[model samples]
Every structure is written in structure tokens, then in C-alpha cells.
Target chain A: MSIKKVLTGNHAVSYGAMASRVQVISAYPITPQTQVVELLSELVADGKLDAIFVNVESEHSAMSACISASAAGARAFTATSAQGLALMHEMLHWAAGARLPIVLADINRAMAPPWTIWTDQNDSLSQRDTGWMQIYVESNQEAFDSIILAYKVAEQVFLPCMVVLDAFVLSHTSEPIEIHDQEKIDEYLPPYRPMVTIEPGKPIGYGALAAPDTYMEFRYKMQRAMENAVEIFEKEGKLFGDMFGHSYDLVEPYMMDDAEYVIITVGAVTSTARVAIQELRKKGEKAGLLKFRVLRPFPFEKLRELLSGRKKVAVIDRNISFGHHGIFYQEVKSALYPLSNRPPVFGYIAGLGGRDITVSDVVDIYEDMKKRETLEEIIWKGVKL
Target chain B: MVEIRTHGRGGQGAVVASKILADAAFRVGKYAQSFPQFGVERRGAPVVAFTRIAESEEELPVRSNIYEPDHIVVLDPTLLSIPDTFAGLKEGGWVIVNTPELPENLDIPAKFRVATVDASEIAVKYGLGSKAQPIVNTAILGAFSRVLENVIPLSAILNSIPEEVPVKPDANQKACEEAYNMTRIRK
Candidate 1:
């Protein structure tokens, strides 16, 4: 029987890990994401969960434990945010290249400048080139479902996956999430069988230093593995949908079919953008939203299809690349550059430094989209005007 | 729709309280969303979490930080002396505080409904120890269950606690029951 439970994004992540039957958990406490480890620690301590909880000294150590655990033929999990993720930058490349298939829940927080501990998308987006698949969540329920899907996809491709949620915005926010039965989850996702296993009986070398002769080949193999993930991602997602009631095609769309204009966003911003569209449509505006739930692997093919017929598009990014356009807009524009039927695209960067973005701000963007607006590179919206 | 906000330190169960409140509300068939506003996620630091309970779909562009909470549960009464604690409570809204000594001399806004309970005392009496977590949330939920009659039933909440706590089940159940009884409706 399904039971309704109010859970934060953090708790949902832990619950997902529990449902995934995670064999090992390695984590160090970090703000915004600390409660995630805290709850998991409580579960492990109380013997409610049978997983091994490895208490590491730092984020780097935490990631290391996960890597080791995964290499030892276990379903490993860990979580971190902000600088903690930054600290694991080198090992992130290690985990992906080694093909350990570890799942990480990254509570997206802003990197230090004025030394702030607030919610932003830069932390996870900055790790885009590390050969890890990234998934953004709009709600706690999505956070719960994303981690389960993440584990399945990661194991299928033997690559690491990161499920990103806004730190304070979604991480600590509570929402009603339906908890699935263990038997059903087990039926939906079977036990992880490693394509590789390292034990004393079969000793194997991992992450051996490569010379110029094999370095490019190793990197190429990693690229091919990521490409493989794209297909497996679809298969696993379809399977998840067949069993569960909710499903999305890597990227989730809201009223985008046969639309004159579209606004693009990621994470929780998509929820607000949908609300804005509803308000605008009431006034007879032909507007819709293309929410990018999966940031990594770019979903370039889907972007091409969604933007091909639209007249105008605006990409809203929570992270600024500093001195250049918003990162997401650059990706969107480049993805559509080859197509002849591409729409006029605009980029808007707003809500940095944990400044909350409101629905009226979204309505304002849709109004501008209706006007078919343009700027040089990226325009900053909602500036106390 | 009724919005509830909980104020406490980082280590406290403010966020958990918000979740339990939302869960209880949902158990009774109300739509709810609970979220926290945190800057420093360090222990003992002040933290704020919010919940929105409605009878219909919850739609908004900008999710506000509970500018006008229908009810405010103060896990730490000392926070009253701190700045910006009770800034935006709606007039006629209820404030439940966890302190033995109510601020009799303190000026309360007219039309405010105020109630006081020694939540820590009840927690200690129930062997919740100095780590005032988990229980405070339950006690507050029990008190709230009584106050907001239609929101949730107290029995539903007791049934939700995991079965692993076999030894202290009676204490927790009693603490919640006592808190439900101890709640004094505002005159």
C-alpha cells in the first residue's frame, strides 16, 4: 500500500538511497546538504537500515569511500554540495573514468566569492565536463524518483551520476511525497550486478597512470561510455515509467506543443515557469515552457526538436558564467545553430546570490517573450525596476 | 489555506516539524508544501522552515518565506530576544512557545493568540535527553493536531513513528498525549 509522507528534498534523497538498497554510504557533513547525511546516519545508527555508513573526514574522503565501495562490487552512495563538490573535482574525474557507477545527490549551492552558503545551480553545472550524468529535480518527489533512476542508469552504463537539487530551496523544503513499498521498488529495480568486480580472487588495476600513447584512447572510451548512457538512460527511464506512474524524457516539457514562444529553465524554476504560462494563457498569450531536467549530455537532439518551430525562445539560467552569457543559453544556442528553422533565442540571467525569483518575474519574462525580445548576449531580469 | 512556519536552530527539528505538519495535513486530505530558509547549515545556528496547507492546487510564481504565518511554533523561546524572530505573524494568529516562563511583561501585538508550554520539560520527562530532537516535533504536532482540529488526528501521527523505538514508545506516546492535553486555547 502507498502511504503519503511529507519529506524534504534531503530526506527524499535518503529514502531513494534506501529504496535502491544501497550497500554502502560514505559522506561528510556540508551545509544545505548536511541533513541528508544526518538522516542517513540516523537510519544506519538505529539499525533500521542494513547499509554500511562510512564516516569520512572530508568530502574528498567521502567520494573516495564511495569509489572504493563501488569498485568492491557494492551499490555505493554519497552526498555533498558547494565547496564539498569542488573538493571532489579530481576524484569526480576518477570515479567516472574508472566507471564505478556511484550515485551522488548534490544539493546545489553557490560557490564562494563573498563566502555565501545559499542555493544556486553553479556547483553542479560546473562539474559538467567530468563525464558524470547530471539530473535536476523540481520537487522533493522528483528528488526521490531521480536518485532511483540515477542508480539504474549509472549501473547500466557503468558511469557515475549526480542528481542535483537546489540547496535551501528544495533541499530543506518539505513537500508531500509518496513512499513506495520495498517489494515494489525491488520489483521495479532489481539488485545491481556489477559488470566489473574487484576482489582478492581477481586483482585488477584501476586508474593506472596513462602515457601519451593510451591517454587519448582512455578519454575516448570514457566519451563512448557517456554516449552509451544516453540510450540506457531512455531504456531505464521507460522501464521506470512502466512500473511507476510518473515519467519524463530526460527533458520535461510543459505545454510546449504548437507554441508560438517558449521559456526554458532548470530545477525548481521550471515549476514557477509553468505557473507563469498558466497565468499568461488566461490572457490569450501563446506561451509554454521547456524545462531541462537533465543538464548533462546536454539533450541537444531534444532541444533541436523543441525549438525548431518556435518563433522566439528565452533561456533563464540561475548560474552566470561571468563575463559571458548564461551557460544554458550558450548550450541552447549552439545546439540549434545547425538547424535552418531555429527560432530567435534570448538569454536572461537572474536570481543569483540566493535572491528569490517570483512568479511575477516569470510573467514579466513571458510578456517580453510575447514581444519577441533580443539582447547582445545575456540580459539580467528582475532588477528592482 | 493556512501557512505555518517553524523557527529553531540548525540541530533542532524545525525542518522535520514542518515536514510532519505537512504529512499530517496530507493524511487528513489537505495539500501542503513545507520548506526551510537556511543560510548557514551549521549546528546551533538559527533556521527557519515553512509549510503551506491548502484545500486546492498550490500555484505560485515566487514562493514567499511565510510573511504572514497562521501559526508560529518557537522551538527555542530564547529566539524571542533575538532579532527578526516574530516579524510577520498575522494578527489573531497563534504563537506556541516552548518555555516555562511566559513573557508576561513583554508587549504582545493586540489580537494575537498566545500559548505557552514547557516543551523541553515534557521532552526531558519522556527521556528524550538533551538532544531535544524528534520528540519536540511530535509534541508540537500533537498540540497542533488539537488546535487545528481538521488538520490531522493525533492517533494518525502516533501510528507513523517507526517500530524500531520499542523501549521509548510509551514515553513518546505519553509526551504527545500530554502535550495535546496541556495546550491552552487562547482566551
Candidate 2:
């Protein structure tokens, strides 16, 4: 049964970890991401959940703790954001390469130099090549649900999973979420029975340096696992939907049924886009919103499938690839490139550094997309031109 | 849909009040969402939280942060000095405020409806917290129910405050009821 509680995305992540009955949580405190572990700490302290809370000193130590704990036959969880994620880069590769199914909630904060603590997808997008499955969520409820799903999907694929939500935007925003009961969640994500575990009698070398002869095979296997997850995630999402009555799709196409023109975005910004698309529809514009819920396993096929027939698409991203273009914009373009009859994809970078992506901005993006020729790319919406 | 913004300092219950109001509305057969303005997370710093009450389940303006709020609740009267507290509030928005006694020089627009309650005094009377800091969030929520067009029932708020406050449900309930009776409204 589901009981309603208003929670921030951080608190929802905490409840998700608790619902899965996570055995071990090793996390270092970071802005936006700190409260996820903080609430877990209280849960553990209050005796509501039995778990070991490892207060690691750094993000590297945190990931290392999770990796080792998962290897030791425990359901391990951790979270990070922005620079904290950057610091965990080395251990991230290790977690994926060693194939430990550690779950992390990366609250997508903008990276620093100008010392910003705002929402952006840059930090997570930069790690796209890493083997961790990335799941982007739009609401506090989905943030909670995705962590549970991440554990299931990651464990199945023997790959780590990153549940990403916009920092501050979703992380700090409170909304009503149906907190599922423990027994129900237990049925959803049963206790981890590690495929391989470290024991007293069994002597095994783990994460040992592979020779050039074997390294490529291991990399190939990781790619194969990622490919397998694409289908597994879709299947598990359907199963979850059946169980919980909340449908999850890799590419959540909102009001796209009759849309000739669509805006493709992810995370919290998609919520604004939905409102904007509906407003446009009121004025008889064939506008729609296609939001990516599962970013890793790329959902390239799904995007291509949904977008192939559309006349035009505006790809809005909160993170940019510096010299290239918006990260999601680039990904969107790539997904459509192989199709001969693809829409003219317009690239846009907006809401970086936690700037608000308002309904008006979505309307403007749609208006801009209508006026743009194929040559007019990289719209950079909201930047002072 | 009714959009609301709540302003308070760190440690006051502005955020919790907004969330409780949303939940109370939801319990009374409405769709509601409450979220905080993300800024510096230090206590004693100014804080803002938003709530949206929609009659339809699918009509929630989730992605758009409340720009022109239909109502504004000031958990701390001191925040009235900050222009940001009233920023984006339209001319005719409802303003519910917490104060020991109503003060003049509140720079709110003339067209707006104003309501004042001694929520802090009620918090102190109920022994909600230390004398210096009374958790008046629940009390002002009582004021909110009265100031608004009774869209949220006081009974629903009574049932909802305990779920939110957690620490002192009885005190919060009592405070909510007293503030509900005492709120002075000026249209």
C-alpha cells in the first residue's frame, strides 16, 4: 500500500533506499546530495531500518566503500553531485569495470569554477561513457521510484546505476509522493544475492590489472551488459507499472500523439515543457513534449522511433559540451542522424547554473523552432545575445 | 489552481507550513504540490516555499515555479522588509502574516487582501518550542485556512498538521485551531 507524504527529492531518495532495505550506505556529504544520506542516517539511528551508515571522508572513499560493500554481498547505496561526482571519477570507472551493482543518486548540480551550486546535466552527461546506467526523473515521486528501479536494473545488468535529478530544482522541491510499504518494496526488489561474493575460504583476485590481451574483452562485456539493460529496463518498468500503477517509459512522450512539432527535454525542465506544450495546443499548435526518463542505455532507438515522423524538434539541454553544443542536443542529433527522413533537430542550451526554465521560455523555444531554418542550430535560449 | 508562496527565516516552519497546506488540501479532495525555493541552506537565512492547489489531478503546474502567487504567507513578519518576500505577487493576492501585533508600514499592494494573526504568541502559549523560537508554522497554517476562501477545511488542516509537524502534534493542532479563530482579515 502507498501512503502519501510530501517530500523533497532528497528525502524521497532516502525513503527509496530504506524501502529496498539497503544493507549498507556509504556516502560523503555534498550540497543537495547531503540530505539523501542525512535522512538515511536518521532512519538507521531511529531503528526503523537496520543498515550500516559509513560516513566516508571523500566521494572517492564513498564510492570505494560502496564498491567493496557490494562485492562483500551487501546491497550498497551512495549519492553525489557536481564536484563531488567529479572527485569520484576514478572509483566510478572501477565500480563499473569490476561490475558491482552499486546504486548512486547524482543530484545534477552544475560544476564549479565560478563557484555555482545550481542544477545542470553537465556532470552526469560527462560520465556517459562510463558503464553506469543513468535514469533521469521528473518528480519527487519518480526520484523515489527510480532508486528502487535502479537497484533492480543495475543488479540485473551487473552494472551500476545513477538516478539523476536536477539539483535544487527537484532535489529541494517538495511534492506529494506515495511512500510504498516495506513488504511491497521487498517484493519489488528482493535482497541482493551477489553473483560472486568474497568469503573466508575462497581466495579470489578482484579488479586486478587485466593484461592487454584480456582488457578489450572485459570492455566488450560491459558494452554487452549495457545493451542488455536497455530491454531489461523497459521490461522492469512495465512490471513496476503493473505493480505500483505508475507507468514508466524510457522516452515519456507527453501530448505527442498529434504533434508535428515537439520539444525534447529531460528531468524537471520537462515539467515546464509539458505545460508550455499544452498552452500551445490551446492555440491550435501541434506542439508536444518528449522527455527522456532513462538517459543511459541512451534510448536512442526510442528517440529515433518517436521523432522520425515529426516535422521539427527542439532539443533543450541544461548542460553544454563546451566546444561542440548542448550535450543532449548532440545526443538527440546523433540518434536521428541515421534516419533518412528525420526532422530538423534544433539544439538549445537553457537553465544552466540553476536559472529558471519558465513556461514562457518553452513557448519562446517553440516559437524559435518554428522560425528556424535547418542552418539555425544551437539556439542557446535565455543567454543574453 | 491556487498558487501560494510562503516566506520565513531559517528554523521557522514556512516550508513545512506550505507542505502541510498542500497535503491538507489534497486530503480534502484536491490535487496539491508544495516545494521550497532552493538557495543557501543556512538556518536564520531567508527562505521561501511554494504550494499549488489544483481542482484537477492533471492540471498541476509542476514545472513552472510560482511566479504570480494568488496568496502569500509570511511566517515571520520580519521578512516583510525584504522586497523578495512580496516579489511576483499580483495586485489582488491574499496575504496571511504572523505577528504578535499587526504593524503598519507593510509595503504590500493596496488591492491585496491582508490577514494577520499572533501565531508566534500562539506557538509560545502552546509551548511549541523554546520561548525565543516558537514553531509557529502550524499556527499560521490555521490563519491560511481562514484567510483563503475556505477551499481548505480547518478539520482537514487539523488532521494534516500532526502528520507534518511530528514533534508536537497536539500543540500544533491546538495552535492551528486558536489561530484559525483569531485571524483578523482585511479585504
DockQ of each: 0.45, 0.60
Clashing pairs in 1: A173-B35, A174-B34, A359-B61, A359-B62
Expressed as tens digits, the lDDT of each residue in B25-73 for candidate 2 is 8888888888888677677889888888899768885665788898899
**Candidate of highest lDDT:** 2
Name the DockQ score for candidate 2: 0.60
If you assessed candidate 1 against the hidden native complex, which CAPRI class would it receive? acceptable
- How far residue B118's Cα lies from its native spot in candidate 2, in Å, is 2.3
lDDT of residue B130 for candidate 1: 69
- The interface root-mean-square deviations, each candidate in sequence, come to 2.3, 1.7
Model 2 misses residue A370 by how many Å?
Answer: 0.8
Off by over 4 Å in 2: B42-44, B81-83, B100-108, B128-134
> In model 1, which runs have C-alpha deviations exceeding 4 angstroms?
A1-3, A45-48, A382-385, B7-16, B41-47, B56-64, B68-147, B153-187
Q: Which residue window of length 10 is worst by lDDT in model 1 chain A?
A: A368-377
| Residue-level lDDT tens digits of model 2 in A1-385 | 6798767789999999988889999999989898899999999999988999998889999999998899998999999999999989999999999999999999999998888888998899888888888999998899999999999999998999999999977887767789977777889898887889977799888998899999999999999999989999999899999888886878999888889999988999888888898899999999989987887888878888899989899989889988899888888888889999999988888999988899999999999898876655677788877
Q: Cα RMSD to native, each candidate? A: 4.1, 2.1
Q: In candidate 1, residue B131 scores what lDDT?
A: 50
